[model samples]
Target: MSGIIALLDDVAAIAKVASASVDDVVGQAVKASGKAAGAVIDDAAVTPKYLQGFSAKRELPIVWKIARGSLFNKLVILLPVALLLATFAPFVIPILLMIGGAYLCFEGAEKVWHKINPSDHHSEELVSEKLSAAQLEEKKVKGAVKTDFILSAEIMTIVLNALPQDVSIWMTGASLAVAGIIITIVVYGAVALIVKADDVGLHMAAEGNSGFVQSLGRGIVRGMPTVMLLLVVIGTAAMIWVGGNIIVHALNELGWHLPYDVIHDLAVGAAASVPESLAGAVEWGVTAFLDGIIGLVLGLALIPVVTKLIVPLSSWLFPEKQATPH
Candidate 1:
């Protein structure tokens, strides 16, 4: 009886430790996920564009397909890469992060430049006679999955960087897995809702028996365009702020801290000049604005290099056009 009691106590202790570890990992995962919110918001905002022109019945199904692809990208492709880097090539993490951050900056800046210039919108859709509906859907899904891979890489790297190096491998893995699953679900689920909301609203407006309910439905339908616009605005701002901050921090990590310190000192000085009740908000806003400015400038610089030099070089190296033997 004594031996059995001792064994039971040992098992209980093990269970307690396991439970504690889980709690710790999950806590860290949540915090780490927050650091990638800019990418998350950008993901959510951008995904709905993939549903355009698809039939109503096909929207959710298409989202599910893209969501599965995203999960695979995060778990099978990016997560292992993240872990391997964390374990072996830790120094490479920050450099890759800066590259991803620069990408975000370029995208955000391009959006701003367009907004200021207000160029005429032109549809780029090609009416290929050989392409069927299935092929078209497949092409769109592939494009979306490709885009998700880039965003997923950014998110996973950000999450990995957020973790402490002292953490055990198991702890790190658990945190990453949890974060990946949670973020994938949140992003795709939001995409589904956003894509379907207009249809649902239209249905309710057309079919609802009561006048007040129909009015509410019409309001929802009318508000969706504004909602989408707001999401884009929010996402663009987040990309610029987050991208610039990442680049600045990376520079700091690489022993070039002047830009970081200057931004910090300037923000603090501005905050000190503000009213006491609103000082914190003022500081954050100023910092974000300056960071966004940096992001914009960096992005604009890259635009020419990327468009003229990089694109031409890449085309010469990996030409998408191949001569077919007739």
Candidate 2:
């Protein structure tokens, strides 16, 4: 009787510990996931274009395919790399993060530059002209997956960096895995919804028995363009703010605290002058704006390097024109 009671007690104790660990893992995952929201938003905002020009029946299938690719990117590729970095190359995380931030800055700056001096949008049109429907679909999926890999890499790295310093290797891995799964699901699920919404609206408007349903369909069709534009604006803002914040934080970590300190103090002072109810909003807006400015400048600087050096190297390595058969 005594032995059985002791065994039960041990089991209960073990179960309690396991339960606590699960809670911690989930809590940390959620918090870490939140840290990558800027990237997450950008992912959601940018992905629907991959489905553009596809038939209504094909849109959901395309999104589903891309979502699976995103999962593979995060889970099979980036997650393992992230874990290895957390375990062996811990010191490299900050550097990689700074690089990623610079990339974000570059992308955001390009958007701003293009907006200010509007370039003809030719890629999609050209692709549409050159590729068959199947070929175009494949190309879009490949492009989306490639883009997702970059974003996933950044998200995983940020999540790894956000974890507690004393965390065990297994815990770090678990938290990151959960965060990656959750983020992938959230981003692509939202993307699926965004891509299919117009189709849903069209079906309802044309086939529905009710006039209100038809009107709603018309509204969705009209609203899609605006929604896509809003997404672009939001994505650009997020990239700049998040990128600048990462660089600023990296600077502080590297013992150059001046930029961060100045920004923090300025935000505090600005908040103090605002009404109590609006102080928090004012602080966040001001901070984000300043960060965006920094990101824009850094991005603009990188643009020349990318265009003159990186682009040429890539083109050289992967020439669009194939060699003729001997």
Candidate 3:
């Protein structure tokens, strides 16, 4: 009897420790995930565009496919890379972040440029060319997955950087896994909701037995366009702000601290000019504004370089076959 009780106590102690570790992992993961909000928001916002022109019945399936790809990107690819970087090439993290940040800046600037110079945009004449629905779906999924890889890389790095240095490798890996799964669920779940909102509204509008229900449904259908536009605007701003902040911080880490220092001082000055109670908000706003400005400038500079150099190099290296119209 005494021996059995002792063994039971030992098992209980082990269980308690395991429970505590699980709690710690969850807490840390949530906190670290918050640091990557910009990337997360942009990820969610950008995904819906891929579903455009697809039939209502197929929207959920496409979202599911992309979500699955996103999970694979975070878990199988980025998680291992992040762990290896954390363990061995810790110094490389900042460089990778800057690269991702540069990409984000380039993307945001391109969007702005295309919007301003709509005539300069690539002719989508090829879009109307005949392609089986299956082929088009495959093409879009592949493109979404490719885009997710960059955004996922950014998110993982941010989470890894936010973790405590003293934490064990196992803890880092476990926490990252948790964060990735949670974020994937949240982001794709939201995408699912956003994509299906119109269908649900249309159904209610068409089949609802009451006038009020029909009006509400119509309202949702009408409101979605504005909501989508707002999401795009917010996502673009976030990409610029986050990208610029990452680049500025990376430069500081790499010993080019002048931009960082200048931005800090400017934010502080702005904060000082405001009331003490509102100082923090003012500082953050000023900092983000300056960061966004930096991102815009850097992005604009890279625009010509990318169009003239990077795009040409990419096309040369991996020339895409132009599909002939049947």
Candidate 4:
């Protein structure tokens, strides 16, 4: 009887420890996800665009396809790379982060530039027009997945960096996996809702038993365009801010502290003018705003270089295959 009681106690202790470890992993994962908020927002915002022009019945299917690709990108591809880098080549992580940040900056700035100087160049759209419905759907899914790869890389890296330095390899992996799954579910789930909202609204408007329900449904349908535009704007701003923050922090880590110091000092100064309760918020906002400005400038500078040099070289090196629409 004594031996059996001791064995049961030992098992219970082990179970308690396992439960605690699981909780820790989940806690860390949520915190790391918060650190990668910019990329998360961008993922959510960008995904809906791929569903455009698809039949109502097909929208969810496309989202599912893209979500599957996103999962593969995060778990199968990027997760191993991130863990290896964390294990062996930790120094390279910051450099890769800066590169990813630069890309984000460039993308965000290009959007701003396009908004400021609207261009009629719809080359992709034109190409898409030539493809059959199935082909176009495939192309769009491929494009969205490719974009998600970059963003996922950034998100994973950010999550990895956010973790405590002394965390175990098992803990790190668990945290990252949890974060990736949570983020993927959140982003794609939101995309699914956003894309299907119009259909839902239409159905409700047609079938609702009450006038208020019908009116609300109509409002939802009418409001979707504005919601989409708002999402895009929010995503763009987030990318720039996060990109600039990453670049600045990376520079500081690399021993060039001028930008970091200047931003910190400026934020401190701004915060000093506010009440104590609001000081923290003010400081964060000032820092974010300044970082966004730097990101915007960097992005604008890269635009011409990317357009004039990178795109051309890329096209020369790996030309895209052309396919006619059926």
Q: Which wins on lDDT, candidate 1 or candidate 4?
A: 4
Model 3 over residues 38-89: C-alpha lDDT tens digits?
7898899888878878898999999999999999999999999999999999
Whole-model alpha-carbon lDDT for candidate 2: 0.83
RMSD vs true structure, all candidates: 3.5, 3.4, 2.6, 2.6
* Local distance difference test, each candidate: 0.83, 0.83, 0.88, 0.88
Error of 1 at 261 (Å): 2.0
Q: Which of the two, 2 or 3, has more lDDT? A: 3
Writing each residue's lDDT as its tens digit, candidate 4 over 1-326 gives: 99999999999999999999999999999998999887798789877867778898999999999999999999998888999998999889889889988988998898898778775346655777778898989888997898788789989998998999899999999999999999999999999999889888998899999999999999999999898778778878887887898899899988899999999999999999999999999999999999999999999999999999998897778665322431
Q: What TM-score number comes out for model 3?
A: 0.90
Q: Candidate 4 at 172: error in angstroms?
A: 1.0
Single out the weakest 10-residue window by summed lDDT for candidate 3.
317-326
What's the CA error at residue 194 for candidate 4, in Å? Answer: 1.6
Question: Model 2, range 168-225, lDDT digits (tens) per residue?
Answer: 9889888988999999889988987887788888899899899998999999999998
Expressed as tens digits, the lDDT of each residue in 37-110 for candidate 1 is: 87788788777766777798989999999999999999998888888988898888778878878887877777
Give the poorly placed runs of model 2, Cα more than 4 Å off.
1-16, 116-128, 207-211, 317-326
Clash numbers, per candidate = 0, 0, 0, 1
189 in model 2: Cα distance from truth in Å?
1.0
Position 18, candidate 4: lDDT: 100
